[model samples]
Target: MSTYVVTGCAGFIGSNLVDRLLAVGHNVIGIDDFSTGQRRFLESSLKSERFRLVELDLLDIDALQRAIKGGEFVLHLAANADVRFGTLHPRRDLEQNTIATYNVLEAMRANGINQIGFSSTGSVYGEAKVIPTPEDAPFPIQTSLYGASKCAGEGLISAYCEGFGFRACVFRFVSILGERYTHGHVFDFYRSLRANPNELPVLGNGKQRKSYLYVQDCIDAILLAMEKAPEKFNVYNLGVDSYCEVNDSIGWICEALKVSPRLAYSGGDRGWIGDNPFIFLDTARIRALGWTPKLTIKEGVLKTVEFLQANEWVFGARD
Candidate 1:
C-alpha cells in the first residue's frame, strides 16, 4: 500500500479523496488548518487506522516539510477558491493558491516525494477564444486573480518537474458538483430560497454557460491520470462532455427542492468581476483515458440539491 500526503484534507474534495484512498488499501496523511474546510467532512477518514490528520497551515514550511516525510505522493488541493470575491482580497489568491503551492513543492522536494497531483481550475482560460477549450488552448489575458494565481501555481509545478525531476499530474477541473458540495450556485440558491421561497436573486442573466463534473468522477479522472499517464508533467481537463446554462442548473435545483422562486436576474452578462459568461472545457484528453462521468449535468445538479437539502448544516458550517 502506498503512503500519500493530502493537503486540504478537510475540504469537500480532499476529504472525499482521503476516504477513497483508505478504501483502496492505502495510507494517507491528511493536512489542513480548517480555514475554509469543514471538520465534519473528515469524520469518516479520521476513524480509519490508516489515516492521520495533521492540523496546520501550508505556509509553515518547516512544519509542512516534517509532516510530509516518507510520503510516496502528494495531492495538493488547498486553495482560496473564492473566484467571485477575488478582487476584494487580491493577496489571498497569491498567498493561498500560488505561494501555498510553492510550499507544497518544496515540502515534497525536502521529503524526497517525487509524485504530486495538483487540482487546478478551468477558469485559467479566461474568455477562452476556443469553444470547448482544449488543454493546448492559448491562454487569454487573465480576467481573475484566482485564475492568475492558479496559472502561476501550474508554472511552478512545471519548473519543479524539469529542475528536480518530479513527476506531476495537474487536473484542471470545471465546477464540481455532488455530495459534500458546500459552495457554488446550488448552495447560494438554496440558502436564498430557504430565507424566502418567493424570490431568488440570480447572478448574471441566468444564461452564462458552464461545465460541471460530479466530485467522484473528478476524483476518478485525477486518480486514473496519476497512475496511468506516462509523462513527467501531465495536464488534463476533467469535465463532462456537455455544458449547461445557469438557468438549466437553477431549474434542476428548484425542481429537486419543489420550489419555483421568482428568478431575479442581476443586470449583467457576467455575475461579478472576472466572471466568465461562457466556460466550456474540452475533456477529450481525459476521456481518451477511458474515464467517463456517470451523471449528466441535470442529474449532477439534482444530486447536489438533494445533498444540500439533507445536509443543511453545511450552510452554517461554511458561514
Candidate 2:
C-alpha cells in the first residue's frame, strides 16, 4: 500500500496509470491542469476513496510542493506533448515540461522524497543514425522543441539523483496508442474520415516509419523498471520490437472502419517541422527485466481506431 504521487493524472497515460495504482491497493494523489487532459479519463479513479485528484498546474511551485508533501514516489508524466505545433508557442514546452520537471524535483527534495519515475520520449534521438536506436545511441541535434524540453527534464532528474541522493527511472517512450488516446495521427485520420469517408488528407508521404506501443504495455514497462532496475539514475527505451510505416497504419485503420478513403498526401517525407521519418527503439534493456509488449503495432493501431469509434465524445471533450 505504497503512496504514489502521479502528475498528469487526468491525461491519457496518467489516468491509466492511476487506475493501475488504485487496482493494486495503492493510495494515489493525481495532479493535472486539464489543459490537454480530460476529466472523463479520471472518472473511474475519482470514485475511489484512495484516489485524490488535484486540478493544478505544476508551474505553481507553492501549490505543487504542498500537494506532493507526503508521497513516497513521484510518477512525472505531465508535459506539453504537441510536438508538431510546439514551435507555434515555443515557450509552452519549456515552461510546461522542463521547468515543471524542475519544480517537481525541488518539491520532492523539500519533502525528502527520493524516488521518481519520469516519462520521457524517444524524440530526443532526433534523426538518429541507428535503425533501432538503443539507450546508448548518440543524441543527435534535437528536431523538436518538445524533444529538447524532455531532454532538459532528463538532465535535471539525473543531476538531482547524483547531487541530492534521489533515485530516478526515465522511460523514453515511442508513440503510444490504446484506450483513452485523444491525439496523434490515428486520431487525426479517424476524425478526418468521419467528416468525409470518401477522402483522407494524409500528412507527409505516409511512408514515415515509426514504432508504437500499447498504452498498457507502456505502463507495464514503467512499473517493471521502477521495481526491478536498481540504478541510481536509470533510463530505458520502452517500445515494441517491430516498426510500421504510416501507410501501413492507415491501411489498418481503414480496414477497421470498412472505408476506402482516397488518400491525399501532403507532399514531403516529414509530416511536420519536427516529425521524425523513422523512430524504432531497441527495447532489449526493458526486455531483459522480463517486460515485453503484448500487442503488435498493427493490433495497437486497430485498437486505437476502435477506441476512437466507441468514444467519439473524447474528440469534442479533449479539443
Candidate 3:
C-alpha cells in the first residue's frame, strides 16, 4: 500500500479523506495545527494503526519536511477558509493559504515526493461572465482575498510541476456540505436558527446563485482525479451539474429543521466583501473521468441540516 500525507487532516474534508485512505489499507500521515481544524473530526482516523497524526503548522518548514518524508502522495487542504471575514484580517489568507502552500511544495521537493493534490475553490473564478464557468474560463478580477490566495497557490503548484517534474492535480471545489461541516452559509444559518427559531438573518438578498457538492462526492472526485487523470499538471472543477439560489438552500434547511423563521435580508446582492453573486462550475473535465456527484443540492443541504441538528456542539467548536 502507498503512504499518503494529508495536510489539514483534522478539518472537515481532510478528516473524511484520511478516513477513506486508511480504510483502503494505505498508510497515512496527517498534519494539522488545530488553528481552524478540530480534533474531534479525526476521532475515527486517530484510532487506526496505519494513521499517524503530526501536530504542526505548514509554515514550520522543518517540521513539515519531517511529516512529508517518504510519502508517495500529498493532499494539501489546509487553508484559512473564512471568506466572509478575510477582509477583516487582510494577511490571514496570504499567510495561511498561499504561503502555507508554497511551504508544502518546498517540503515535498526536499523529501522527493512527486505527487501533490490541492483543494482549490471555485471562488477563483471571481465574478465570471460565463454561467457555468469551465476549467478554461478566463479568470475575472478576484473578489476576495481567499480567492486570490487560492489562485496564487494554484500557480505555485503549476510552477512546481513544470520546473520540478512533479505530478499535480488541482480540484476547484464549489461550496461543499455534508457531515462534519462546521463552517459556511449552512452552518451560519443553522446557528442563527438555533439561537432564535423565530427569526433568521439571511445574508445578502439570498438571490445569489451557487453550486455545491456533498463531501463524499467531493472525495470521490479527488480520488478519481488522482488515479485516472493522465497529465503532468491536471485541473478539474469538482461540482454538480446544477446550481441553486441561496434562498432555495435556506428554504431546504428550514424545511429539514421544521422551522419557519422570519427572513431578514441584509440588503445587498452579495453577502460580504469578496462574495461572488454567481458561482456555478462546469464539471465536464472530472465527468470525462467518469466521476459524478451522488447527491443533489437539495439532498446535500437537507443532509447538512440533519448532521448539524444531531451534532450541535460543532457550532461552538472551531469554525
Candidate 4:
C-alpha cells in the first residue's frame, strides 16, 4: 500500500480522491485548512484507519513539509479555484495557486518524496485559437489569473521533475462534474433555483461552449496515468469526446429538478472577466490508454443537480 499526501483533502475533488485512495487500501495523509473545503466531505475518510487528516494551510512551508514528511507521493490539488472572482482578489492566485504549488514541491523535496500528481485546468489555454486544444497546443496569452497561476504551478512541477528527479503526472482538466460538486455554473443555478424556482440568473449568453468529465472518470484517468504515464514528466488533457453549451447544461439541471425557471440572460459572450466563451480539450492521449468516461455530459449534469437537491445543506455549508 502506498502512502500519499493529498493537499486540499476536504475540497470537492480532493475529498473524492481521498475516499478512492483509502478504498484502494492506500495510506493517505490529507492536508487542508478548510478555508474553502467542507469538513463533512472528509467524514468518511476520517473513519478509515489508513487515512490521517492534517489541518494545515499549504502556505506554511515548514508545517507543510512536516505534514508531507512520510508520504511516498504527493497529490497537489489545493488552489484558489474561484476563476470568476480572481480579478477581485488578484493576490489570491499568486499566494494560493502558484506559491502554494511551489511549497508543495519544496515540501516534497524536503521529505524525499519525488513523485507528484498535480491538478491543472484547461483555462491555461486562455482563449485558444485551436478547438479541442491538444496537450501540445501552443499557449495563448493568459486571460485569467486562475489559469495563469495554475500555469505557473505547472511550470514549478515541470521544473521539479527535471531538476529533482521527480516523477510527475500533471492532468489539465476542463470543468469536472459529479458527486460532492459544490461550485461552478450547475451548482450556482441549482442553489439559485432552490431559493426561488421562478427565475434563474443565467451567466453569459448561455452559448458558452464547455466540456466536463465525470469525477469518477477523472479519478480513473488519474489512477491509470499514475500507474502507466510517469516518464520524468507527463501531461494529459482530461475530458470527454464532446462539448456542451451552457444552455444545454441548464436544460439538464432544470429537467432534473423539475423546475421551469425564467431564464435571466446577462447579455455577454463570456460570464465573467476571465470566463472563456469556448473550452474543449482533446482527450486522445488519455483515451489512447483505454480510459473512457462512463457518464455523458447530460448524465453528469443531471447527477450534479440530483446531488444538490438531496444535499440542500451544502448550499448553506459553502456560505
The RMSD (Cα, Å) of candidate 3 is 0.9
Q: In model 3, what is the error at residue 221, expressed in angstroms?
A: 0.4
Question: Candidate 2: deviation at residue 249, Å?
Answer: 0.4
Tell me the TM-score of model 3: 0.98
Q: What TM-scores do the predictions have?
A: 0.99, 0.99, 0.98, 0.99
Candidate 3 lDDT over 72-177, as tens digits, reads 9999999999999998997999999999999999999999999999999999999999878999999989989999999999999999999999999999999999
Give the Cα-based TM-score of candidate 1 against the true structure: 0.99
Q: Candidate 2: global Cα-lDDT?
A: 0.94
Candidate 2: which stretches are off by over 4 Å?
none
Go through the candidates in order and give each one's C-alpha lDDT: 0.92, 0.94, 0.92, 0.92
How many pairs of residues collide in each model?
0, 0, 0, 0
- Candidate 1: tens digits of C-alpha lDDT, residues 93-188: 999999999999999998889999999999999999998999999999999999999999999999999999999999999999988998898889
lDDT score for residue 175 of model 2: 98
Superposed Cα deviation of residue 51, candidate 2 (Å): 0.5
- Which residue segments of model 4 deviate by more than 4 Å? none
The reply for model 3, stretches above 4 Å from the true place, is none
Overall local distance difference test of candidate 3: 0.92
Predicted model with the maximum lDDT: 2
Error of 3 at 45 (Å): 0.9
lDDT of 4 by residue, 1-319 (tens): 9998999999999999999999989999999999989999999999999999999988899999888878998888999999999999999999999999999999888889998999999999999998889999999999999999999999999898888899999999999998999999889988898889999999788999999989999999998998899378999999999999999998988888788999999989999998999999999999888899999988888888878878888989888
